[model samples]
Target: MGQVITFGEVLMRISPRGKKKFIQSNVVEFFFGGTELNVGVSIANFGGNVKHIGVVSEDFIGDTAISYINKFGVDTSSIGRSKRPLGVYFFEVGAVMRPSTISYNRSHSSFSEIKPDMVNWDEALIDGEWLHWTGITPALSQGSFDVLKEGLQKAREKGLTVSADPTYRRGLWQYGKDPKEALSELLHYSTIFIGGINEINEILGTEYSYSNEDFIRASKQLMQAFPSIEKVFDKIRTSLNSSWHKIRARMWNGKKFHETKDLDITHIVDRVGTGDAFAAGLIYGLRRFDDCKAMEFGSAACALKHTYEGDVNLTTVSEVTTILEGDISGRLNR
Candidate 1:
């Protein structure tokens, strides 16, 4: 089995205890999470050897972040320490009919200030068969973008399969550069992309309506523009309330489109890292199953992530396979 290597930031996520509002909370909970790092944890939990590469502050806060990811069995040897402080964010869990909210305090963090030389691509990527990243890294700063571009170049030279999640956080892209320019250059080396049509429009400058036909048009446009991309996928979500969501997913594998059935989730424990969970599942499925089965397994992982509290999806392959097989009975096993 080959190793999956993820490149991105690891943030210190602070949440209010329980369903309390941020202002009303007396206690807080902290965890380490970020786009690529979250996917790394999910793949590791599924029994895959994964390596996470990012910078951490030379402080205890950074130490804690490293320990958190390490707990999930992800290799942290490439996560270096620096003088800048670790990035952090605060979010409040919302119940039915109320929407969740997030506030970030991540500027000037170690990972954001990272340079291309900071990450030794040749050493960090040794024995790495898959490389995963997200748009969030490029949105951080020019320095982060440069590092990502260099890393992606090296990953391509090494003949590794590259996957990316275009997580376009509006507020994170205030670094005075157009996201399209930065992302397009890096995505030229990507083989798999996970994001919605809106994200594709924002980053690729293509007009795509939320219709099924338009999705195909957009996917074709994307693949044409970037010949390196072989597959484009997205999870279609219908939120009935803060607690209930119905999710299905679709993927365009250059030659055809494959979709999954709706996985209704009426009780969402946490929805923070569901997309990353889906990305991990898709990567896992692509290696072991066909496109249709991969979409089903990936969507099942997304649905199951809603029942977990933290950013990392701790569900196993057997558990996800059970859900994919229509065994969402939630019954106990002896």
Candidate 2:
């Protein structure tokens, strides 16, 4: 298989240990992750060839972050450096009835300084078969949006499949550009839509409810609006509480609509990056299995991510397959 190229920021995530509020705990834990980086790392752990392109601080912190990604076997050669501190976010992990909260401090970080000229799209897309991008990257700054647009254009010219996950955050789009306009332009270059009805409604400025029927309608409207989008995949989550949640996946691949059984996660260790795991699983699966099986793989991967603590899903292909085979008992293996 050719390489999967992921482009976005690399962030250092800090969290209080074990559901403790910031005021209740003096200790914190840190992990390296970003939306696209998490997807790239998970795919790499699945034994797929993956490369991540982003910017980090030109310091030891950046060195450590690169080491973390390198240990996962993701190619980091395309990553660049700048004379700014690495972006950092503080995540307060909640449990039971409490909801998790995140605060970002990435306004002047190195990734926000990225420019289209810094990335040699020809070199990055040379061996790439798929390119993955998220709305967060473009929401950072105009420069990031331009760079991502340029990369998407290059990927299109090279005939590489482009996956767009418009993980929209109203707060992130502090730049003057309209979120709908920016995301709409990027969606034009993407072939796979890794989001749901809410996202589609947000981009298209429509009122689509959460019903499955509305989901199908919204997806069809989305495909009609953006002819480049061939498939739509969504990970539906039903949260019982911050710690207990259920996940399932549904997809409309032009011809048929498929949905998977809900994978109940009674205890969630960390909820961050689960969506990225689903995206990674789908990308890996679509290249190997049929559409229905691929959606199942994505949902299984997403369910397994809750068992890990960090921002990236560390589960291997065998582990995910075990879950897919109906083995969520957490049984001992000798």
Candidate 3:
């Protein structure tokens, strides 16, 4: 398998310790994560070859971020540095019934300063077999959108599989570009769609409900509109509250629909990056397993991510496999 190429911003996540509110905490914790970076790190942790391309502040903070990514064995050679500060978000981890809150301070960050010419996509994607991108990149700025589009185009030319996770954020599209237009354009280059009904409805400007029947209908319509999308994989989450959730995945791969059983997560250590984990697992599994097994792998990985605290999923491949093999007993290793 060739390297998995991930392109997006590198963000520093700052959060109050545990379930305490910002006003109640005197101490905080920080982690290095971004949607694409989290997926890259999780893939690397699973012993996959992965490379990340992004810009960070040309300061100690950026240095530390690079080091943190390097610690996960992710190739960061394509990453650049800028005078602007690294993007940061303050998160307050919430418990049952209460929801989590996040505030972004990334408007003028180093990643938003990215330009098309800043990266040599041909060189960055030379050894890449899969390229993953999210809606967050293009939502930041015109420069970021142009840069991502350039990379996607190059990946297409190189015959690499492009995975699109249209993680649309209504508040992030303040750059005047139509969200539907931008995402629809990128979808033309993507082969796999790693999103659900909400994303499809957002991009296609259709109102689709959350039913499985609607999902199949929406997915069929999506493929009809964008024939390049060969397969659609969705991770469905049922949140009983902030602490307890159930995850299951379903896929429409042109000819058939496959679904997985619900994986219950009774105590979520953290909710962030669980979707990215699903994407990573699906990417990894597709290389080795069939479509149904891949969806099962993704759903299991997503459930396991809630057991770890941070924006990145650190669970190993064996651990995820253990869960997939029906071993959710939380047994001791010793």
Candidate 4:
């Protein structure tokens, strides 16, 4: 029985080891990443029983994925496999003022063609306290959306809390349907809903400023639009450069809206998976303590992501705690 169950694709991320780009470099490194998978992996790293549910190709890449995710302590027994090839992504980690670029080669991959009846949700979420997913799945295909809705409903009936990140990526959804339709439908069933304010505005057909008031209005509107959401967490960021960032998060938990202070992050090795890190932290907070302290852990975890170089963060619990304690002094640990 898993305590945390998540479903999402996992891709092989190929990029240069440091700041060099593809054309300007040789000797690129390999790591695996998928937002849903990242959340499950992070929970496992923090000493939780985490299960990753997704389909992978039966080829060599799929074989490698089992090994890759196993190292992070996620239970891999619940995954589905097919005789196809896994998806691949190319990344160029930005430096200075340049934005990072991602080129996905995932068309016709395992997940895009996944069937809804592939996994036994009853067994997968038997003792699950939480089930999480993202809007990205709906963008993949209608089949995947049905699979997610089924899994989440089963979790709901079993009295498990459902959480989701409306990580609306522009490139993922195909087949001529707007993301708003699918996302709105899914959000109606979620206990907690999270998203980027900018992403939501684009879908909502509105303009918003970068101030707290703007996000405050956005959360209020989204919460009213979908009443199943008891809480909304928005991770607000202000980028200074490719290597540094200022971030804070706000939460609207039914009763009131709360905001955390801005955290200055330096030496950011990667940013792709940071939002998932925030969600993991927020979920942990929801399960462990009151909303304020939970927000603290969630914010701190995002800071720790800036220090790591892969899709799954490689930092220790103590390290995250130190950051949570406001020690950005960067002292070495034993």
Candidate 5:
């Protein structure tokens, strides 16, 4: 199998412990996480050769982030150092009837300060067969968008299959350009895309009515607009509460639509990296399984992530396979 490459920031995530509000908590826990970095870690945990490329400050927080990435068996040799501060976020976990909240302290961080010339794309993509990135990266700053665009161009040139999570965050795109325009350029180079119905309408200018036909229509329109696109997919989440959610996934693989079983995920330990888990699982499955099986595997992997308490899904392929094979029995294994 070919190696996977991802480019984005690695942030230090701080959250209160055991249902404690940020204001009330006396103790806090920290974890290393970011969209692309989370995916790289998940892929590595699944026994895939993966590399995480990004900029980090020459501080202890940056050192911890790089060490965390390496601990997961992800290659961090391409991680560059900067003088800027490392990015960090404060997360407040919510209980029933209340929603979780996140406040970013990521502005001016080393990764957001990245320049287009900092990375040698040729060297990064040398042994890479797949390249992954998220829309969140470009939303940070103008310089970040430029580097992301340049990376996409180089990844294309190297014949690396590109997958992107079109994660639209309104707060981060303060660089004075419409997100639709910036994301359109990146989407043009992506072969596999992951997003929701609302994101489709917002970014691709397609009217999604939550119907099966409209999904197929929108998927076809998206592929037509960007000829390089081969597949578009999404994991639909139905939140019963902050602690419980039912997740079902679907994919439009150019010719047809495929949907997976709905998984009722309860007592979610940490919901932050579930989407990245699905993305990683989908890419992993695409390398081995058919579209239907791939979607199922991805959905199963994400469901398993709810049991873990960090940003990265530490679950192995065999664990996910057990869930995929309808063994959600939490019984102890000998």
Candidate 6:
């Protein structure tokens, strides 16, 4: 088993319970979420030797984040704590006919201000074998983008396997320049690429498409463009309305391809970190089983994430094993 390392910001997610806006909020729940840190936590929960690499504010909020992370047995020594303020996300959950919304207060996030030297690129993943990153990181600022490139170069030199999923938060990107150039640089460095086609199209410079075959072909072009990359994966969605969606995914594993039927993800509590959950599952399978069996296992884990309530997935290894053994009926487990 190899160690896993992830780099990105960690935010305190404050979300309203039922159907209350931020101004009209009476009840709210607090859960920590940042795509990269969430992925690190999930990997740690599965007993992976995981270390979250990023900068955190030296304030009370940063302390709070570290406390919760410590409870999960994550290594925080490598996580830098600075004199900055922590970042947060305000979310408003919606009911059947309503739509949910999330607002990020991560403008001056500690991790966003990261410099290349903050992470000793050559030393960070010295004991690690896998590195995972999200698209959200490079969208922060020029310094962070440089830091990612520095880190990726080191990871490549160390012969580490890299996985990237550009979750595509278009709202956060338009900082200084276009997102295409930066996104492409990072994608070229990744071996396991996981993302959605619609969000990726903007970065790939393509036109509108409602065709599945077209998506696979375009995604294939990207995979072929980067010979270092072994697989290209993305989730597909058919929206019936604001709150209801039918979601499925397809994968191209260098040699063969596979796709699954869309699962009705009606009880979506937090659709934010589901993509990371899928990537985590996929990588876990790829490391454990052969190519074909791996994607099947990954797709099952993602389908299970839809039924859970938080950004962190609740599917246990035993549950995933059951699903992997050809059971998507998802009966209750008590």
Instruction: Report, for every candidate in turn, its global Cα lDDT versus the true structure.
Output: 0.89, 0.94, 0.95, 0.82, 0.88, 0.77
List model 6 lDDT by residue over 59-170, tens digit each: 8889888988877777777889878788888888776777778888988888778887788877777788999988889988888789888888888888899998876666
lDDT of 4: 0.82
lDDT of 1 by residue, 1-334 (tens): 7899998988988998888897897899987899899898998988889999999999989888888888988999999899999999899999999999998888989898888778899999888999998989999999889988998999999999999887787788998988888788888989998988997898777788988788988999888888999999999999999999999999888889877889999999999999999999988888788988887888999899999988889899999989977898999999
At residue 253, what lDDT does model 1 achieve?
87
Rank order (by lDDT, best first)? 3, 2, 1, 5, 4, 6
Residue-by-residue lDDT tens digits, candidate 4, 1-334: 3488889887888998787889988899988888898887887787778889998889888989988889888888888888767878999988878889889988788887777779889888877889998987878877788889889888888988889888877778876777887777777778887776776585566687757677778777777777777777888888889888998988777677788889998778788788888888787777878998888788888878877888986655677788877788987668
What would you estimate as the lDDT of candidate 5? 0.88
Work out the TM-score per prediction: 0.97, 0.99, 0.99, 0.95, 0.98, 0.92
Once fitted onto the true fold, the runs of candidate 2 whose alpha carbons sit more than 4 angstroms away are none
Which of 1 and 5 is ahead in lDDT?
A: 1
- What tens-digit string does per-residue lDDT give for candidate 2 at 20-119? 8899999999999999999999999999999999999999999999999999888889999999999999999888998999999999999998998999
Give the Å error, residue 333, model 5: 1.2
Q: Relative to the unseen true structure, what is the C-alpha lDDT of residue 51 in candidate 3, on a scale of 0 to 100?
A: 100
Backbone clash pairs for candidate 6 read none
Candidate 3: tens digits of C-alpha lDDT, residues 1-334: 8999999999999988989999998999999999999999999999999999999999999999999999999999999999999999999998999999999999999999899989999899989999999999999999999999999999999899999999999999998999999999999999999999999999999999988889999999999999999999999999999999999999999889988999989999998999999999999999889999988998899999998989899999999999988999998899
CA RMSD, predictions in order:
1.1, 0.8, 0.7, 1.7, 1.0, 2.1
Clashing residue pairs in candidate 5 (N, C-alpha, C atoms within 3 angstroms): none
Error of 6 at 334 (Å): 4.9
List the lowest-lDDT window of 10 residues for candidate 4. 196-205
Off by over 4 Å in 5: none
Candidate 3: minimum summed lDDT over ten consecutive residues — where? 294-303
Model 4 quality (TM-score):
0.95
